[model samples]
Target: MTLTRRSFIAATSAATGLIATPAILRAQGKLALRMGHPHPESDSWQDVALWMNETLNEQSNGEITLQVFPNGLLGNDPTMINSVRAGSLDIALTGNPFFTSLAPELNVLDLPFLFRDRDHVARVLDGEIGDRLRRNFDGTGLHALAVWETGWRHVTNSRRPVVEPADIKGLKIRTTPNPAHIEAFRLLGAVPTPMAFTELFTALEMGAVDGQENPTTLILNSRFYEAQKYLSLTQHAFTASPLVTNADKLAAMGEDQRNLLIATAQEGAKRQRAMNAEREQSSLEALKAEGMEAVEAPDREAFRAIVAGPVQATFAAEFGSDLIDQINAA
Candidate 1:
């Protein structure tokens, strides 16, 4: 059978056909795990969340039911990760700069124009480099279950459209509070104001920051157009959210259950990436309908030329140039 994102979701949603009664389920004592993320329920992470929840509920015969908390209900990115590490939360899907904020080495992947496209990104992240980054969770209180693409990061502003490299100069842009992100924009000539994702909309509306960088899925889903005017398809970098669980909690699960959970996570990751790609194409039109103006061919090469050297140098000095070479070679 074909396994498109929509098909996968439909399959999973119907997975609970043989679900047990609440009383019987209560007696059976399910895992009742909590999974939290900062994105809206309409975002890719939530798509993954819903799929995993239904799949686990069916596959485990209701012994494992994930209680998902979306829209930062459990907390913001760092708080969610910290909760997972402390064993207070079962899982969290963390976006860039959040994962990089905790593990500085992973910041190398977010450098401007590093990923050529989604295929190149999946190749690198699902290969040796991805394994290396995931392994960094070892000895930390967290266990990395899977990595999913949130999609290609773009540029949006309440000011002028980012048509060229020079257009970004002096405009205060909101960035994730990761060193690499802040430094990359600084090198690209924007004043990078790092802040929590929860505060971004208000910041833009208040003119606290003239712009922010995020994927089109997020920009449109979160309705950033209400606060910003222009959307530029920079596709400068890729956004990835790592599915993480508390090390101790995950280690205590039975081998079968652990394997099942990982399998479900992989399935969700695959579907989520495909869904994000499809959503990006449609969301551009949705954003325009909501009053966002799209700028065409915003000198992607020019943006890359200006930021590549300094940003790559920053990464090389911090993570060793050899690693950068390895990723480029990947």
Candidate 2:
């Protein structure tokens, strides 16, 4: 399930059988495009973005050139999303949970323990539920091309190990500004504090927050191990990042180029998800080597049993029982 960057690019290039240098594309009306995300350069998504850029450049015979912005250099999720909507930026890859601020329907995905694992996530996001979520972007002036992965989220803290639901009580935990997640954590007896990822390490180091939750890729790449001593494999929720673009911008690209972008992005997401799944164990081991202890086993059912009723009730009232039920049934 693991794929190296070089091998990914080689496979994409070989599959397309269409190759051209950037210089050649520049001569043939190259369209300069840009995509941004919040993760550091080491994130699998970043590599996939770069891979998509190169594939598009060659696939379009240099008619399309994509520039990638990593580490929030372009902007955070909200900022980049606004820029893309304004047509000032080309594309973005961000978690759907964050998009709830704009489109509340996205909250359905952030529900705790909503997805069993990566395959379940893929099943939910690749089926009708996924299509409906993608189309929901139109109201926000964005077009979603493919839904990507951020893997499952786990907990890390500087205080002590978290192996039981009671162990989390009174601890200030960091979370994205999603109501469902915040409410879920609150129901778990933890004080949920929403903040930007860029400020997380300093927050943890300064004791601004006791712990945070994120995927293994982010925990390792962002070096959260330096400030947090313990990691619990909670796998409470999986993050789905939609690779999107401005609706108007996509329309202007014409049929062929637009299709190529979508195709390359989907392929890139496939490889990126594979790379993340492959890296989970190695990344955890690396974190341990770097001095962070892993609470390898936790009582998932206990955690779920406490939060399930309240979260599901809240989601049903806000998003309708049918929507939540559909996701569970899927």
Candidate 3:
């Protein structure tokens, strides 16, 4: 039988009760892991982290313990990533775009307008493209456990509704220090300011940055809408976060333990995607209730056209024209 969302939830609920099953306890010993992400405890990323912790603990019969540090408790994404690389941290869930700084070839995933939707993103990442990206981590001292999708990113600002490319003119938009993002917003006529995720709320509230772009789930969870009144449904980019582990730590685990971890992470990814989709659909209502003016602009195509040229020029040499052609075709 096909597992609908309801069935999946029911199955997970049933599985939760099996936490103390003897069979799970015999295969995997008690293990503790520290995982970090920059978002707050209320964010979907944190929710997924908790889900992974619960699922792993249950599946391993309380043998595996996951401690999650949310809200940049272990520093920012880059810092957490470096910590994992150095083996100071056991695991992390981080944005894929940031990986571009470490492995430039991975930047192919960051290509603007590359993903048409969630299904398209999944197809590429779960297929050959994902395997190749995983191989890039082989010598980097880290293991890519799973790639999970974050919802499509949109724009939120205190400035005004962004109906067209020109509407963003002169707005200082806070972006992750990812070059692709900076360039994409620059093409949209905004002065894209790269800032750490921790600094964004203050930046928005203090008027240091006039706006920022993120998915609906993030904006709502981060409470950015409380400070910024305008939300533009640009859906300009779709994002993924990698569930990573210290290579040595993963290598030390027995084959059964390793398989369990990967399987639990995959389940966590599935749960996260479903939770994000549900939150995205309902979040607008919450935002509206909070007095934020949500605008659905009709000119997404115009914004896409503006960034297409710059994205191609920026990564044409690395991605090659053929791959770009294929992604665009899809």
Model 1 per-residue lDDT at 291: 88
Candidate 1 per-residue lDDT, tens place, 247-313, comes to 8877887787789899999888889988988888788889988989899579999988888788889
* CA lDDT of every candidate: 0.80, 0.82, 0.78
Best by lDDT: 2
Q: Which residue pairs collide in model 1, if any?
A: none
Please give the range of 10 consecutive residues that has the lowest summed lDDT in model 2.
16-25
Ranking by lDDT: 2, 1, 3
For model 3, residues 60-122, the per-residue Cα lDDT tens digits are 787886767777766788888988888777888878876777777677677677788888887
* Best of the two (1, 3) by TM-score: 1
Worst ten in a row by lDDT for model 1: 18-27
